[model samples]
Target: MALNPPSPTPSMFRKKKSSSSLGPMSTAASYLSAVRAADARARARGDTPLTTPALSLSSSVTTSSEDTILDEGEESYSDILTYPSIPPTSEQVYTTVHSEFGHCSNEEYRAVSQHPAGKPVAPHVEQDPPYYVLFTTYISYIILILFGHLRDFSRKYFNPGEFKHLVPHDGYAPITSDFDSFYTRRLKGRMDDCFSYPVTGVAGRTIVLLERESKDSNRTFAPTGRKVRTLNISSYNYLGFAQARGGCADAVEECIKRYGVSACGTRVEGGSLDLHSQAEGLVANFVGQEDALLCSMGFATNSTIIPALVGKGCLVISDELNHASIRFGVRVSGANVRMFKHNDMKDLEDLLKEVISQGQPKTHRPWKKILLIVEGLFSMEGTMTNLPSILELKKKYKFYLFVDEAHSIGALGPHGRGVSDYFGVNPRSIDILMGTFTKSFGAAGGYISGSRVIVDRLRVRSHSHTYAEAMTPPVLTQVIASMASIMGVTPALPTSTSTGTITKSRMPEPEVPEAYPGRALSSSLPTWMDLPPAMREGTEGRDRLRRLVFNSRYLFRGLKKLGFIVYGHDDSPIIPLLIFNPGKMSMFHRLMRQYSTPIVVVVVAYPATPLVTSRVRFCVSASHTKEDIDTVLRASDYVGDVLDLKHSDGERWPLERIMNSAVELVQMEQPSHD
Candidate 1:
């Protein structure tokens, strides 16, 4: 999550003084006192406020006409504040944090008025040559002083509409060479297309299949030397469904032919349709579960389900690397959350043991009601979860499990049924299974599948479906038809196995657990993750994810062959090419600006990622051909070689340099320590 907004500062206060001799100090002093008292009372009630007001003076004026006669040769208060003999000139401008709430009177206000201590001050003592000049001259000088002070005050405070006009025009100097260089590098990199590959209308090599158009939808032009177009990388479409699949198009056309585009209201109202129920059944059928409840988006599925299932007494054991959506949902659930290390079975076991030992005394249940949550596939690492091991652990410590298959459905297991199918574990074994239709199916919606009771409970209880409108009919029809085609649920039957299971004779099998409830009866496991049909002893989701890994490896290899040291997993698609010594990220961006590439660089600063890790993230996609990968690698190679950076696999070398610096500093501090 991004950092919180900064707190307001207290330097804006003005010390209040007595406006009248008979009265106490300015009203601001009383206000502060009241605020302090309120704070004291709040603290007594155990509440702490983040902001408090400071004292300020009120406005008052007292003067006498008789005081207008000034003594000759006496200096004015204005003369003390401003030297009229010297011409006014611009002072240095420095950036400063400012206050919005405080206001003070200018020198002009003080000049003709009584002091805060109530001593009378002289009024305008002008012996004017013209009657009009007498009042006009004094008024004009006072107005100028007041305006000047007001400008100063405004500059020092943060006003909502007032923002600094921070422009990097040609003649402006930069605060630091390092910062300047960073922006420069980013601009330069962007100009040269170092972040992305060549395309027709896109600068990036990979064509991001987007379901909806974004701000840059019309900017589909790339003109590198070889020519290119814009390519969007952050698209959620995975299965190429958005490109108008024959069967999917038929389904949508059929839906439109019958139901138009939408069902039009909340599902509980008039929006419920046969298509909605059909899609739910298709999802449950694909996963080989009893029932499923569908919601508007996959984000809402988990976001709604988590908070609904777990409550105050429930302890939610979540993987530390779970998605932001899951973390958010958990927060709203009001359940006690314990974070386990990412993919660490030992950590999960320890947590389970601790919960069992600690929680049993307070509740009637023996901690078996505890919920364990994990992702089927880690999005960042592109690594598959160890579900077989997790299930084994689950067996040993009997906790309810919730698996998010956002990245797994239509991408893993036998016929892409997700993690359980990939592991040959029956879908029913998982307590709650959630998935989104954004990826693979190339549509939008999410579903939670489990027992009929759970499905019914969620249908009535899940906040997302209960409150949000049902999915549009056309999108639902397309998604349902797509999943059905993939799972062979309709007329495409029996070429596939029953109960979403298939047998294989590829290898020697491990001992199956006796009557592992809901375990699929399969003679063979899928090979999409492992090597093709060779019976390799690798992993379950191994075969399915190999294409991404292979693409990443080839890109890394090709880029390295061109001499650029990149960061990130070799087996993962998102690669970060290290630009450790860029002049500035802005410069890099400028360089890549004209280049027909679209890779984005991750900016590293003192507060962001460390300077040592400054680099651009290059994401490879399955949509990228070998030629496309080669072109991107060569461009990076050109930029790196031009910049003359000595690329290492990823080591800074001279390990002793940093260590020796520490030692020398320690030696210098020895006398002081002694």
Candidate 2:
């Protein structure tokens, strides 16, 4: 009987090509028909493949065409594509055991090794068993260690979930080691309270666009589906200088040409350029001082200038409501510091008396100096300094006066010459005049304009001034240009005062004609009094200060006549129709969205302002015309009626109630040093 062959079993791996064959011409025809049919169906369905099923058997193959795949060894083209298949498993080699004579034995081999039926045999090794086992274990252990390290690295560097667990959330302190647990805990609490209040979720009413087809053009936010840009405020471009006379563009161009890009190093190093000197010169001339020293920043101007001017033997008497920058600078100076009550002349006199009393003792330094520090204007409450009173006390105490004219420099005094001019105090009387270029000049940097001796002393002695990066060439250049443009054209103060001191006799009656021309008596005097008291307080005060206040009055009357309970003041441009609760800010913001004109709010919160003071600050700009202001007032009135601020006391806070509440709120916001 003939030996039978074993049947083939299916293998795990599948081959891409089949080994079966067909009659030559018939196979080619059948493949062509199949591919053509496929192409027709794909075309009908709008499907396209990268490579066509057509095969080129021509010797001169065109490999450039993507739709054709060329095959080797054929003389003509064919529709079918072919690939060779693997041989059967039976054809592969298998290890087998045989007799020493190299022949299979009929009887089962029983000598040294046994060959089992239907199985392959391995070749025997001559090496020692222990050596082989040791090598195998070494290789396997190394592979496992490598795999473990790879898993650890991936978890540390690339796993998003693992990284998220490592970071701290907004309210919490990051997991850093700390030396002071109490301090860290307190800081974390403050941060949490500040962030917890929600400002974004307030409902905003859609502003009706005056454009005829605006309804279809309105866009909704993607995530929350809310409309943004309903009302906007909180911008620092005071005096609208950014848009003044191509000022912004000129600044940018100058900055680019001189500095190229960055100040490369600190002021003492590569940063100081010739433009810086030009700016310093201009500032000194404008302030009517002999010389000036420039610094990289305004904060540094205060922090560095104060500490340098007052040290071990000096005393600094500060106004209690002074700007935070001034307070911090005083603290850092390590001087014997005392604070007087806000704008209280009596309190200031008492403090000076105590300083003078102590200074008279023989044990103390004989040449001691007391520096009185105060701001020209209080930023938050819009209050101003009693310069006449302070100057009177200064004459008695012989203390040096250092006033921060930060807010007042750009907005107060005749031609904005600042507080010295406003109160008719000579720049020489102040001893040292420090101002920043960032504000009215529309640039950055600061300078101390004063007697040459004081400025020269500070130039070398100030720590940050000596060590910090200097102002950029372009920024300094722009500052110089702006000073030249504004100060050069600004009319000068009448000069040659015949030596009269400030007294009660010179004080004008409150109801004197609002517009007082010839306020500056002489052309020789570089500084003259400008801002009157009424300009800083109440309804009449605001009206005297700005045109916006007038518009606000018109708006208020219109709104009142229209029967809306409008909140806040017509005297002050910052009017807010009070919404009693947190829930109402959203509704107020929403109604504001429906107006054609924008009425932005300056939002205040728990940490920034008191909860009671948590209302929008509606600011009227000088840029707004009477018509524009009227439109805004009408819209606000309409919205106020809709929100129902008229009936509730919370909605309409009286001016006195508002002022008292403001004072209390300020007290609360201040940090308790004790």
Against the true structure, whose TM-score is highest?
1
User: What are the runs in model 2 whose C-alpha is more than 4 Å off?
Assistant: 1-233, 244-248, 262-271, 358-367, 489-596, 606-621, 631-674
User: What tens-digit string does per-residue lDDT give for candidate 2 at 405-473?
Assistant: 765564454444566655556667778877777655556777787888998899888976788777766
Number of clashes recorded per candidate: 75, 21
RMSD of each predicted structure:
32.9, 36.1
CA lDDT of every candidate: 0.49, 0.46
Cα displacement (angstroms), candidate 1, residue 266, comes to 6.5
Q: How good is model 1 by TM-score?
A: 0.52
